[model samples]
Target: MARRGKKKGRPVSGWLVFDKPVGMGSTEAVSKIKWLFQAEKAGHAGTLDPLASGMLPIALGEATKTVPYVQDGAKVYRFTVAWGEERSTDDLEGPVTKTSDKRPGEAEIRALLPNYTGVIMQTPPQFSAIKIAGERAYDLAREGETVDIPAREVEIGRLELIETTPEGNSIFEIECGKGTYVRSLARDLGRDLGCYGHIATLRRTEVFPFTADDLVPLDALEAAAPKREEAAPEGGRPFAAQGERFVALDAFLLDTGEALDCLPQVAITDDAAAKLRLGNPIILRGRDAPVQADEACATARGKLVAIGEIEAGMFKPKRVFAG
Candidate 1:
C-alpha cells in the first residue's frame, strides 16, 4: 500500500499496519515502530512468532487504547505444514516430538478441513505466551512442568486446504476468530486427519480491518522523516499530525462495523462533553438505548468532544476508541 503521508511536523496518532517479515518477533516489531515514530507510546494488537510473519497491527499514541478492539477481529492466515513429522511446539521451532505412519495428500487435507470449521475449543500449546498463574506458560513447559492450560473457545470461520507439494508439504488458509494459535490449529488438523503434522511456515494475511496490503514495510517505517525516537520511551507516545484529528474516538470500533452496526450513535451538546471529560458518566439518547463513550475528551463549555458506550440503564463504558 502507498504511504499515507502526514502533514509536515504533525504528531501522528493512528493505526499503522505492518507487513512483518520473517524472523522478527511481534514485540520487536512494536519496538521498531516505537523507535521510528519516536512517539510517547505504542503497542501491537496481537503477537506473531519470530518464525512466522505477516500483518502486524501497530498502535501509535492514543491509538494504543484501541488495541483490544482490533484484537477481537477475526484473523486469516496462510500456512504450510510438513507431513509425517510432529514437533513438540507444533511448529518447526520445536524439536521432533513424534512421527506418523503415513502422509496425507492434497485431496485428503481439503476434505478434512470442513470438520474444523465453525465453533471449536482450542487447547493452546504450552509453548505460548498465555499466562498460567501469572507466569508465562511456555517457560513453565520448557522446564518440564505440566501445567493444564484450559481450552478456550475459538471459531475457524473458514478453512481451505489449498495445495500439497510432492515432498509432503501442505498449504492451507484459515480465517478464525481471536485467541487462535495457527500452530495449535496445525496440530489439531493433523490429529483430526490421523496424519500428524507440523507447521513449516506461517504468515498472517489479515486481521479484521487491517490486512497485509494496508501495511508499511518495516524498512519504510524505520526510514520515516523527522524521526521521533529521541524523546520517547520504549513504546513511545501518541503523535498527532498537525493539530488533533477528529476520528470520532470510536473509529477503530466503527472500522469493524460490528459494534457500530449493532449500536446507534448519539450526538451530544458541548455540555455533555464537558461533564464527560470531568469523569461524570452521562447517558445519551439513541434508538436502541442510551449510549455513552467510555472515555470523553473535554473541550470548551462541557461540550461532548468524545464519548464511549455505556451499559443499558447504567453509565458504564463498553468501549471508547481514541480520536
Candidate 2:
C-alpha cells in the first residue's frame, strides 16, 4: 500500500475567540473556522446553541489539546427570561408547553435568586446535547420522546436580575461554573414564581481564560480572508495564500499556551525539554521550583514543551506539544 499522505491544511496552532452570531451552531462554526484558517484540526471548547450568541473559543491544530481547560472554567451568561410562557425546548425556538397569567414582581424574583445561587441540582433542558444510550437527547426530544435527564450539581457563583422589562421579560446575568444551563434557570425560576418562562435571549460574555474583549466577529474574519472570487482556477476554491489576507486573519489567533496560563508554569532547561519531549521525566532544580503539583506546563526558551505533573521535584510529561 502507498504510504498514507499527511493530512491536508496548515499546521496552525492557537485559539480564536469568536463572537458567534445567533442562529449558528457550534459545530458549524468550528467547520467554517477550520476551513478559513486552513488548519489540519479544529475543535471548540464549549458548544453554543443556535439560538445563543457570544464567546466561542475555537482551537486549531495543537491548541485542541487544551480545550478541556477552557471548558472546565467558569462561564458568564447574560440572558432574558420571557415570563408567562414555558417552551418545550426552554427557549423561544420551541413551542409553548405551558403558560400562566401570573407575572413575577421584581421583589419576588430577587428573593428567588438566593435559592439558585451556590451549588444546586439542576436538570438539563430536554432539547439539549446530553447523550442517553448513545443517542442525543435533542434527537429523542424532536421525535417527542421525553428524556428524564438527571439533575446535576452545578455551581452558580453569582446570579443577578439585571432588570425587568415592561413586557414581563426579566434580564439576568449569571456567573456560573461548567455544565450550568441558563435555559433551565429560566424554566425553574418561572415555576418557582408561579409564572411560566423561556429564554428570550442568551449571550455568553465569558468562558474563563477568554472574555468578550478577545472576541472577533464572524463578518470581520470573513472580510479579512481571501475571497473565493480570487481563486486562480475559475471553479476551484481559493488556495490559502500566505499574504496580507492570511496575515490579517492569523493576527486574531491567541497563543496556544494562553489556555494553559492558569496552570503553574515551569521554566525548564533545554536539556530537560528534550527529555520531556522524548517522554522522560527530568529533575527540577532551584529553590523556587515547585516540588509537587498535579498539573503544570513546562516551557523552554519561551516555547511550550509539555503539560505534566510535578512530584518530588521531577517533571513527568503527560502531553507533549509539537512545534
Candidate 3:
C-alpha cells in the first residue's frame, strides 16, 4: 500500500488585528484564530500578557514574514495604575507584596510625567516572559527563585495622565517604541511618587500602523466562521473548500503589504521583481527615487515582491515574498 499524504490547512495569508480580551494569552489567541480559519501557519507580532488586553496583531502565512516590521513599530497603550498596592507580577494577576497609603495629587502626577518621558532605564517585572540564562523569568519567579532582571533603556515618545479616580487609581496613556514595558512604568511611577502601585487595567490602543478601529473581537471572528454544514458543497466533504468565498476567513485579513506601511515603498518592473524573487540584486530606475532609509519595500503591479536595501543604486533583496 502507498503511504498517505500529510493533512494540511488552508494557505491563508495577511494580518488580523485581534482585540485580545483580558485573561487570554497571546499564544491562546493565535491558536483560536488558527483553528477558526484553519490556516496553515499563524503567529503574533507582539506578546500581550493575559492580564492585559487589546491590539494583538495576528499574522498568518506570508504576513508572518512581515512581523518584524510591525513589531519594530511604535505602540500606544492606555492603562490604569492603582496607587497604594504593588504586586509580584506588577499587574492585578499577582499577589500584593507591598502597599502604601500615599496617593499623589493630580498636580503631583503631572509634575512627575516629564521624568518618565524620553529615554529611560527600566527593570522588567520578575514574573515576565523575558528569559534569563535560557529560562523564563516567570518560571523562576513562580518556583520562588530569585530572578534578577536587568534594566534596559527604552524610548517613551509621549506620556500623559488621562484621568484620576477618587479611589486613588490614575489612568494614563503612553506612546513608546518597542521593548517599553508598561508594567515597569507603572511600578516606577509609584516608586517615584513614594506610593507603591500596580496596573489595575491595561489596554493597547495602537501598534504602529494599526489602531483600535482595526481590531476585531474574537467573538466576532468566531461568529463569522462559516457553519460546517453551510460550508459543504454538493458531492464535496465538509469544510474542505479553499479560498475566501468558500469560508469567508479572508474577509478579516489585511493585505500583507499594509504591515510594511511604516517603511518607504518603491515600485519596480516585472523583470526587477522576478530578479529579486530569485535572490538577485537589480539596479533601480532613475524615475524611482532612492529610498533614504536603509530598507524599503519593493512592489510590482501592486504586489509586494521583496523587502531589500538600497545601496549605491542597487536594490539587494533581504527577504523575498511569494507573490
lDDT of 2 by residue, 19-82 (tens): 9999999999999999887778999998999999999999998899999999998999999999
Residue 151 of model 2, lDDT score: 93
Per-model TM-score, in order, reads 0.75, 0.94, 0.92
Give the alpha carbon lDDT tens digit for every residue of 1-323 in model 3.
99997555667788999999999999999998888787778999999999899999999888999999899999999999999988988998889989998988999999999999899898988988889999999999999998778999999999999988878799999999999999999999989899999999999989989988789998888788877555434475423454544345668778899899877888999989999999999888776679455999899999889998998878899999988
Best by TM-score: 2
Q: Give candidate 3's TM-score.
A: 0.92
Model 1 spans > 4 angstroms off: 1-12, 227-275, 280-307, 310-323
Cα lDDT listed for each candidate: 0.68, 0.90, 0.88
* Candidate 2 wrong stretches, greater than 4 Å: 229-245
lDDT of 1 by residue, 135-170 (tens): 999999899887899998889999987777778788
Listed per candidate, the RMSD to the true structure in angstroms reads 8.1, 2.5, 2.6
If the candidates were sorted by their TM-score against the true structure, best first, what order would they fall in?
2, 3, 1
For candidate 2, list the clashing residue pairs, or say none: none
Candidate 3, clashing residue pairs? none
- After TM-score superposition, what is the CA distance of residue 118 in candidate 2 from its true location, in Å? 0.9
